[model samples]
Target: MLASLLAGLGLGFSLIVAIGAQNLFVLRQGIRREHVLAVVAVCTLSDLALIALGVSGIGLVLHGVPWLAIVVRVAGALFLIGYGLLAARRALRPAGETLAVTGPATDAASSASSGTLTATRRRAVVGTALALTWLNPHVYLDTVFLLGSVASSQGDGRWWFALGAGVASVVWFAALGYGARLLAPVLATPRAWRVLDAVIAVVMVTLGVVLAVGG
Candidate 1:
């Protein structure tokens, strides 16, 4: 049981620690300090639920449905390409004031001053978080198919393994979402933001193209 748990935890961290669309989005949200908690919660919860499904052998069912994978892949590709274009636009025409880093006090004041706008922004952020998580076929492939297959090999220890994976998801997202603010100072300038967005654009578009091509 202990070995299975450790194996799951290690695998979970290894899978999630990579630089991917979901991680990049979470990092951006963390730096902006925009609905960070909500983003973290959404990611962590989604991961846990997926891991559970994987452990319960749902991956086998999904594997049997080839058309479902194709549909998801196409939809994910389109969404990623669209998002990438938006990021490219931001890189080309950055709104310096909007991207400027602010202290907690200033953010509080601004939120209070523009309550309605803040609420709207919160909803948008949450929606983006959901879209990013759900629209990525890789999430299902890695968490559901791969992890589920491995968990099934654990036999009686599968549940323990799933629990460890769930814990890893919670810890990783919490650390990533909260820790990214430390880089806020470094990205305070518009030039830095432009560079970051350009990188994001390239990565997103490339991934989309690869997915579209059935890679």
Candidate 2:
């Protein structure tokens, strides 16, 4: 059991720790200080649910219906390409002046107005989170196929391994969603936003194209 748990933890971390679309979105939200908690919950819970499904042998269904993977890949690629274009626009056009100038404008009333802004963007953020997590073929490949196959090999210890994987997912998203605030100072500049958005744009577009090509 202990070995299975450790194995799960290591595998889980290895799979999720990479800088992917989901993680990058969470980091951006954290830096923006907008809907961070909600984003974290959605990501972590989605991961746990997928891990559960994988442990319960959903991978067999996935493997049998290979078309499903292709469908997801196509959808994911389209979404990523669209999102990448949006990010590229942001990189080109930026939002406003630096935080140093607008810092004072964020008073109670402004904060309240920002609350409204956050509320409106919440839907978009949640939708993107879901798409990024569920639509990506790699997610199914990793969580359902790879993780499930390995867990099944553990026989009786598979559930323990699943639990460890779930725990790692939770911890990683929590840290990423909240800890990113530490970089808020650095991201206060428009140049910083431009750079971040530009990088995200490239990543999203690249991944989208790769998925489209079935790579």
Q: Pick the candidate with the highest lDDT.
A: 1
Q: How do the residues 9-65 of candidate 1 rate in per-residue lDDT, one tens digit apiece?
A: 866775675445677677778876778999999999999988998778643553577
Candidate 2: tens digits of C-alpha lDDT, residues 33-70: 67888899999999988888877864455457767656
Candidate 1 TM-score to native: 0.63
Off by over 4 Å in 1: 59-110, 183-215
Model 2 lDDT at residue 150: 56
The pairs that clash in candidate 1 are none
Which residue pairs come into collision in candidate 2?
none
Local error of candidate 1 at residue 84 (angstroms)? 26
What TM-score does each of the candidates earn? 0.63, 0.62
- lDDT of each structure? 0.73, 0.73
